[model samples]
Each structure stands twice: as C-alpha cells, then as structure tokens.
Target: MNGIDITVSTRLIQGLTNLSLGHVIMILVGGVLIYLAIAKEYEPVLLLPIGIGAILANIPVTGMTEPDGVFGILYNIGIKNELFPLLIFIGVGAMCDFGPLLERPYTVLLGAAAQFGIFGTLMLATLMGFKINDAAAIGIIGSADGPTSIYVAAALAPDLLAPIAVAAYSYMSLVPIIQPPIIKALTTEAERAVPMPYTNNQPVSKWLKIVFPIVVTLVCGLIAPLSAPLIGMLMLGNLLREAGVVPRLSNTAQNELINIVTLFLGLTIGSTMTAGKFLQWETLGILGMGLVAFALDTVAGLSFGKALSILTRGKVNPLIGACGISAFPMSARVISRLGLEANPNNFLIMHAMASNTAGQIGSVMAGGAILALLAR
Candidate 1:
C-alpha cells in the first residue's frame, strides 16, 4: 500500500511540474473574455466562441492546439490560409446596403476623411517604437471596421492580430458611449439642433447599385492588389445582393454561411490568444494605443464634419461627423438622437447614414492603402 501511494504521488508531481505558466495565464484570459461577452455583451457572437477556444487551447494535456487538435486543424484551414476573413467579407458585403451612400455620393468623402485615424494612429504607434508593419496593424483598429482590421493585422502583424481585433470590435460596440461625449463637446446645443432639409432629389438606380461594387473593386484592386482578395469577395457579395435575381444565394451568404464562418473565425482567433502570446507588456500598450486611435478617429471625423458644416454654410449638422467612425447605423442613430435632444423637430438619420456608409468604404480603402504602403 505504501509503495502504491508513493507511485501515485510521483505521477501527480510530474503532472504538476509539466504545467506551464503561459497555459494558466491563457486560461485566465479566456475566462475574462467569456465574462466580457456574457456580462458586458461585447461582440458576444465572436468573443464567446473565441473565449471557449482560448480556454481549450491552453489546457495542459491538450496537444490539440499543437498538431492534431481540432483547433489546430481549424487554424490551418481558415486563418493560416487566409480563407476566413475573405469569407466573412462576403457576408458583410451581402448584408450591407449601399443605398444610403449611393444616394449621396459626396458623403463618400466623409468616409475617406475618417480613415485619417488609421494612418494617423499608425504614425503615432511608430513614434511609440512599434515597427511600421506592427503600427499599421494596430492603427487599423481605430477604423472600427473589424474585418478590415483583422485582414490588415493578419497580413502585416499576425502576432498582434488577436489583441488588435479584440480592441477594434470592443470599441466598435462601445461607439455609443465613446462618440456622444466627443460630439457634444465639439458642437454646441444649437449646432446639434441644426436641422437640414432632406432632399429626395436622388434616386439610386438599380444599375448604379449593381455597378458601384464592381467599380470600387476594380479601382481598389488596381491601386492595391493586396486588398484584391478582400475587395473581390466583398464586391461579389454585394453584387449578389443588388442583382435582384439571387435571393437564395444572398440569403445563404448573409445567414447560414456567415454564421458558420463566424464561429470558425472566432474560435481560430481565440486559439491565437494563448497566454504565451497575449500576456505581455506589448499587449497592454496595444490596448492603450487602440483607445487613442479611436479617440483620434472621432476627432478627425467630427472635425471634418464641422468643416463641412462651414462649407455648407451651417446647413449640415456637424454632429453627423461623428457617424464617420464606421460603427454603421448605430453611430448614425446616435447622431439622430443627439439632434433630437437638442431640438425635437430635427432628424438627421438620412444624412448621418450617408456619412456612416461612407466610413465603411473609406475604412476598407485605408486598410488597403496601409497594406500597400507597409507590406512593400
């Protein structure tokens, strides 16, 4: 009996001795991600699965993440090959309605202007000692465009992709909390209340809608070939949506396909967040810089909006500038709410949508530009 007890104790000691600190830290990080997803409602669709994957990846005996594990297979199939991001873009494009942007082509500039955050943040990160490629990856987080951030980060700084993606999605969801204060500070109550008359002057032709995605894809591809895969997939999805003859295909892209791919993407991303990689001083710094990037983006967008107001002789509500952060209809809705608060009679949703959609396209172009500049 004593001999048996001694053998059992030896085995337990050996097991404990094999445990790695990195694994423990990763498990804790996974727990934190799960809590954030469930309690804070922070990108639950992605974060929850990612959190689970992180937990699974860090288990001591599970060499699953090492060579033959399910996650290892997933990582190889989707992420390493760059299949998932492109697939997700298909869904994003299919779901996106370009009508708002098409109705006011001028608003595309607002989107373009908002991309200042990505480049500006890149320069700032470089000043902070990050290499150019790493800075570019980190900077894209400010665009509040999750997939584009993921694409750029994966291409330029795969090591930093996990944290950058988390930060981008987190900030995107928090747009309501983040943007209002900036908007209020920049514009007085009267400026927020300024109501612009909506003109039904432009009707988006079906042909225009069909051609818009194709033209953008061609133009962006010619300028930044690296972005072609992302842009092509995105445009293909949009074409399906606008063609009016592929409801089934569009529905699959928007629903079943997207749902399936998001699961794999989230899990694969989480697998990359092992404690060995994530529990570093650089991770904290990246988080901090991400917030700075977000704030600067809001400043740039709102400042441009203020300038547009001046250009339009105050007919344009400067508050709509905050919508240029690419948080989509949420940012637009926030602008409309603030406008109503300042003056119950004011409605800026349509105008805000124009800038909001513009921000989306602008973010993609900015991501492409950064890839072109840095990947070289």
Candidate 2:
C-alpha cells in the first residue's frame, strides 16, 4: 500500500500537470515585476499585487482564472465589464484640485496641443502594418493615462491589452527619468528660467466648481455618447469633491474605495500578461511605440509652451508645457523643479499644474473622440 501511494504521488507530479517551460518563464517575469516593485520602489502599490497575480496565474492547471476562481471573478466583474477603471476615475477626480486649470484657460490649449502624440503614434503604427483599431489602441499610450489606455484596448483590440498596459504603466512610473532629459534637450537655459506667475488671483467661486463638472458631462455626453460612462463617472467624482456637502463620501471615494479597486485593477491587468499572450514580436513593436509616443508628447508639449512663452513675452515658461501629459503632479513637479534649477526663485508649480490638469481632461476628451470615431 505504501509503494502504491508513492507511485500515485510520482505520477501526480509528472506530465503537463507539472511546470512547463512557458510557465517557468512567466513565473520569472512575475518575479522580476515583484523585484522592481519592492527593490526599485517603482509603482509599488500597483506592481506588488500585479506581480503576485502573474505568478498565481502561471501555475500549471491551477484554474485560478477559471470561471469560478478569484481572478476569473475579478476580471468578469471588474475588468471585462469595464467597471473598475471608471471607479478608479472617481477616486482620481476626487483627489484633483482643478482650480489651477480653471485659473489659466490657455493652459487648456497646451493640453490640447500635447495630444498630437496620440495621432502621431497612430500614423507610425499604421505604417508599421498594424490594423486601424490596433493602431488606435497602441497610439493611445501617448495619452499617459493607464485606465484610458485599458478602456480603449479592451474595446478596440483586446488581444494587445497586456503589452499596451505594461508599457503605459512602466513609462508612467519612469516619468522622472524620461521627461527631464527631453525637456532639457528641447529648451535653453533662459527659456527654462522664464517665470510663469500665478495669474488666477480671483477666488474660484464654490458655485462654479459645482457647475463645472455638470457642464463638462453634458458637453462630453453630447459629443461622444460612448464616452458618457467614462466622462460621467469622472464628473461624478469631481462633483462629490467640489460639492462639499458629503465630506464623508468624498473621503471614502478618495481613500478606501479607490484603494480596493486599484489593488484588483493591478492584479487583473497583470494576470493578462501570461507567457502565451505577452511573448511576441508584435509586443516588442508596441513597447517601442510606447516609448516613442511619450517622447513625442513631451517634445510637442514643450514646443507649444515655447510658442506661448514667445507670444506672451516670456510670461509663460515653456517648462510648464512639459507638464502637458496625464501623469499629473509628477509631471508638474518635474517642470517646476526644472524651472527652479534654472533660477532659484522660479516657483512654477501652480503654473505647471494648470497645464497638467488640462492634460488630464484633454486626454479623456481625446479618448472620447476616439470612441466616437472608432467604436461602431
């Protein structure tokens, strides 16, 4: 009986039931992601869960993402149905202070100008022989908005979602390393030194704050009905913040609610990066285009800023223009720091934040346009 039990156990560990080469490779990938998250301190909140999920997913015959499994349930309920990303948007909206964007309307123009990277990359992807929908999904990495990227890819090209998402988040976390070099290469010392004073001295009436989101929702809904869910959820979150009647709800949305969704979001996105899905020559192309897209966005944003600086008699620093991607305060901080480096007294955070906020809206708006044109 003992011998028979040993034989049965041996058979259990054999065959495809055990680790395959692909599974091993994927586990290693998962480990690398975890290492980056822990050791390098890169996007730890998202990356940690993602790495753990990837490893869990690659185990042989685990059925962890099967119809009834935790991952499967998460994907079906959150990602596949496109609910979690929108919920996270609510959190994002709640955290943002749009006063800066409101103060400087022209920075909205900088936000619009920076979006050329999306289309420019689309053209490049087309020339590389990607299908139109595939190219559109790939091009949106330039928007530097991971949730938006995931939404577009899930709709237009679900197959490319893994690489597109990984690329988007990776670049987002590397903003400090990537953006400064581009800004420096594009601007002269004098241009960087140009101080952009906070011009919006008028107090933002609380009434206008409440009204702004409602107006934006109506406009976005009319122009791009498909984007209504995205725009609506985002506006609702902002309304919760600006309305000031529900501090309890606002705090919940900003903290606990968003935190939970983000953990699931990261894990689900990572699970999609199985070896079979991610290991491809096409994946390489997507990664390459992602980098190019970000670089182009920075360059285009800075160029527009320089034009504004010239037009406004150096009153607008070109450094603020570099903040015209959807990376939020990080991008703004980069430009502000660069400005300070050029001159100790050049405090440009509020000015750069104006463009950064505008970029967030511009990115979502651009996503709306894509949905209108591409979604059938």
Candidate 3:
C-alpha cells in the first residue's frame, strides 16, 4: 500500500514540478488578450482565438507546438507556405467595392504616397541594428494591413511573427484612437472644414469593372514579380465580385472561407507565442517600433493630402489623404466623422473610401516589393 501511494503521488505531481514562472506569465498574458477581446471588443474574431492558443501553448508537456502537434501542422500547412494570408486576401478582395476608387482615380496617388512610411521605417529599423530582412518585415507594420504584415514577416522574419502580428492587429484596431490626434494635429481648422461635394453619380462601366482587376494584376506582376501571388489572389477575388457571374463563389469567399481561414491563422499565430520565443526584450522593441511605423504612415498620408489640397487649390479635402492606410473603412469612417464635426454638411465617406481602397492595393504592392528585394 505504501509503495503504491508513493508512485501515485509522483505521477500526479509531475506536471506541477515541470511548471515554470515563464509559462505562468504567458498564460496571464493570454488572459489579458482574451479580456481585451471580450470586454473591449477589439478584434474579437482574431484576438479571442489568439488568446486561447497562447494559453494552450504554455501548458506543460502538451506538445501542441511540437513538430507533429496540431499547431505545428497547421503552421506548416497554412502559414509556412504562406497560403492563409493569400486566401484571406481573396476574401478581402471579394468584400471590397472598387467603384469608389474607379470614380475618383486620383485617390490612387494617396495610396502610393502612404507607402512612404513603410520605406521610412525600414531605414530606421536598419539603423537600429536589425538585419535587413528583419528590418523590412518590421517596416511593413506601417501598412496597417494584418495579413500583409503576417505574409511579409513569415517570409522574412518568421521568428518575429508573434510580436509583429500582435502589433499589426492591435494598432489596426486602434486606428480610431491613434489616427484622430495625428489628423487633427496636422490639419488646421479650415483644412478640416474643407468639403468636397460628391457630384459624380454616373454609373461605372461594366466592362471597365470586369477588366480593371485583370489589368492591375498583370501590371503589378510585371512591376514586382514576387508580389504576383498576393496581388493575383486579390485580383481574382475582386474579379469574382465584379464579374457578377459567380455569386456562390463570391459569397463563399466573402463569408465562410474568410471566417475559417481567420480562425486557423489566429490560432496558429498565437501558438507561436511561447515563453521562450515571445517573452523577450525584442518583443518590446517590435511593439514600440510598430507604433512608430503606424504614426509615420499617418503623417505621410496626411502631409501628401495637404500638399494635394494645395496643388488643387483646395478642391480636394486633405482629410481623404489620412484614409490612405489599409485600415480600410475604419479610417474612412474616421475621416468622415471628423469632416462632419468640422462642418455639418461635409460628407467625405465616398471620397475617403476611394483612398481607403487604393491603400489596400498599395499595401500589397509594398509587401511584394519587399519580398522581391529581400526574400532568400
């Protein structure tokens, strides 16, 4: 009886003995993410799964992150091959309405100009002693596009993906909080009050809608060959939406497909946040630098918008320029709200959406350029 009791005690206490402070800390961190998701509603779809994965990853002797474990297999099948982000882009493309951009063609320049933050942060990261590849991955956080950030980081700096992913999504959600101050600080009362009436109500050409995505894919692929996969998938999704012939496929891409992929991607990314990999000084640096990258992108966009306003003699509202990041309709809505606050009659959602859509294409191009130049 005594011998049996000793054996049972040892076996039962094994897990407790193996537990470490790091694991406890990581679990607590996961709890925080979960709390934020549930209480604050910040990216609940991704953050909730990410938080759960983080907790599971830190459990002693689970082997969930082992090479043959579920997370490991998912990571290899979905993330390592870069399949998940591309698929998400298809859904994003399907959901996007390019009519706003087509009607206001010049907003494309705002998107291109917004990419300056990416390059600017790249230089800054390089100067701060990071490798060129890591620097490039870090710079892409400025794009404010989570999937692009993940795609670039996984290819260039797989080790840094955890923090980069967190930063990208967290900051993307905080666009309303982060961008408003910058936009206000950069523009004066008159600039904020500037209103551009939406007088263009002509129907867009159906043929142009069908052909636009094809032309964009071809041109972008020729310009940056590596970006072909990312842009091609995006264009394909948009074509499905615009082609008006594949309602079932388009609906699937927009709804079921994206939701499933997002769940898997979030879980896999979170599982990578193990104590050994995630709890480091470098993680702090990545988070800090990511905020800077976002701020820089906003400043660059707003500056270009102001300049464009000056060149056009105030016909173009500078507020639309701030929507140039890939945060999409959130940024556009922010601009619209601010515009209305400045002047009750100001309606900028249409104009802001034009710039927002352009930013989506711009972010993908920037990611492709990085891959083209840096990928081994």
Candidate 4:
C-alpha cells in the first residue's frame, strides 16, 4: 500500500517538474496577445486565435504543438510547406476591388511610391547589423500588405515570421492613428482643403479587367520568379472576381475559404512564437525597424503627393498622397475624413484610393525586388 502511494507521488512530482520554463514564457506571451486582442482590439480575428494557440502549445505535457501533435500537424501541413499564405492570397484577391485603381491607372505610381517603406526599412535594418536577407524580410512589414509581408518573411526569415507578422498586422490596424498626424503635419491647410473634381466617366471594360490580372501576374512573375506563388495566387483570385461568371467561386474564396484559413494560419503562426525563439533582442529590433519603415513610407508618399499638388496646380490634395501606405480602404478613408475636416465639401476617397491601391501593388513589386536583390 505504501509502495503504491509512493509510486503515485513520484509520478505527480515528475509531471510537475516536466513543465519546462519555455512553456511558462509562452504562456506569458499568450496572455499579452490576449490582452492586445481583447482590451486593445488589435486584429482580434487573427490575434485571438493566435493567443489561444500560444497558450495551448505552451501547456505542459499537452504535446498538442509537438511534432506529432494536432497543431504541429496543422503547421507542418500548411505553414511549413508555405501552403497557408498562398491559399490566403486567393481569398485576398477575391475580396479586393480594383475598380478604383483601374479607373485611375496613375494611382499605380502611388502604390509603387509607397513601397519605399520596404526598401528603405531593409537598408536601415542592414545598417543596424541584420543580415541582408533577414533585413529584407523585416523591411516588408511596413508595406501594410500583410500577405506579401508574410510571403517574403516566410521565405527569407522564417524564424522572424511571428514578430514580423504581428508587427505588420498591428501597425496596419493602427493606421488610422499613425497616418493622420503625419498627413496633417506634412500638408498645409490649403493643401488639405484643395478640392478635386470627381470623374465617373472612366469605364473599365470587362476585357481590360480580365487582362489586368493576367498581365500583372505575368509581369511580376517574369521579373521575380520567387514572387510567382504570391502574385499568381493573388491574380488568380482577382481573375475569379473579374471573370463575371464565377460568383459562387468568388463568394466562397472571399468568405468561407478565407475565414477557415485565417483561423488555421493565425494559430500556426502563433505556434512559432515559442518563448525561446521570440523573446530576443532581434525581435525588438525588427519592431523598431518596422515603425521606421512605416514612417518613411508615409513621408516619401506625402512628399510625392506634395510635389504632385504643386505640379497639378492644387488640383491634387497632398493628403491623398499619405494614403500610399497600402493600408487599403482604411488609409483612403482616413484621408477622406481629414479632407472633410479641412473642407467639408472635399471628397478625397476616390482619389485617395488610386494612391492606396497603387501602394498595394507597389508593395508586392518592392517585396519581389528585395527578394531578388538580397535572396540571391
């Protein structure tokens, strides 16, 4: 009887001791993520799943995130193989509406200009002692193009994926707060109040819409084969939307497919945030560099906008230029709101979108360029 009691006690003690310090750290990280999601409302859809995954993975003796466990299986099946990011691209493509950009082809340049953040941040990171490839990966977080950031980071600096992704999404959510001050500071009251004529006459034909995605895929792929997967998937999603006969497919890709994959992707990414790998000096550096990249992108884009405003004889609002950071409709909306505040009649949404979309495509191109330049 005493032997039985001793055996049970020994098993309990071994179980308690088996709880590793790494698990404890992971739990704390999970708690932080939870607080950010719940209290801070930071990308709750993704962060909530991520936080839960972190907690689950860190639970001692759960084995849920180990090589043979459930989360591990999911991670190996998707993230490890780069399946999740590409799949998520399809969803992104389906949901994106290129009408505003297509109507104003000139906006493409704005998108390209906004990409300055990626390259600029890359250089800064390299100067700060990061490896060329890792620096390039970290720099992409400023693009505000989440998938592109993920795709590049996964390929070049998979180890830094968690922090890079968190930073990218977090900053993206904060665009409303971050961009407004910069836009207001850079543009004069007159510049912000400038009224631009609206145009509804630009008609994008179905043929051009169809051709747009195909052309972009070919051009980007030809330029950087490494970006082929990302560009290809994105274009495919766009193609489905433009094809005009695949409403069902487009709906599924945009909603159901995206929702399901987001859950898995978020959790798998969170699993990578194990304490040993994430709690490091380099992670903090990446975060700092990401902010630098975002600030520079806004500055470069606004400078260009200011130049355009001067050249266009005040026909262009410099505030619209700040939308070039690729935060999608959010940046565009912020510009429009500020425009209204400066002049109640000013509607910069459409104009801002041109630059906003341009920032998106430009960000991807820049990502490819960085990959080409550094990954080789």
All models: lDDT? Answer: 0.85, 0.86, 0.92, 0.83
> Which sections of candidate 4 miss by over 4 Å?
1-16, 20-22
Model 2 CA deviation exceeding 4 Å by range: 1-17, 200-202
TM-score of 4: 0.93
Error of 1 at 53 (Å): 1.4
**Candidate number that wins on lDDT, 3 or 4:** 3
Off by over 4 Å in 3: 1-11
Clashing pairs in 1: none
Which predicted model would earn the best lDDT?
A: 3
Considering only N, C-alpha and C atoms within 3 Å, which residue pairs clash in candidate 2?
none
Q: What are the per-model C-alpha RMSD values against the true structure?
A: 2.5, 1.9, 1.5, 2.1
Error of 1 at 14 (Å): 6.9
Q: Which ranking of candidates, highest lDDT first?
A: 3, 2, 1, 4
Better of 1 and 4 by lDDT: 1
lDDT of 4: 0.83
- Maximum-TM-score candidate: 3
- Across 195-244, the per-residue lDDT of candidate 1 in tens digits comes to 97778766789999999999999998998887788888888999999999
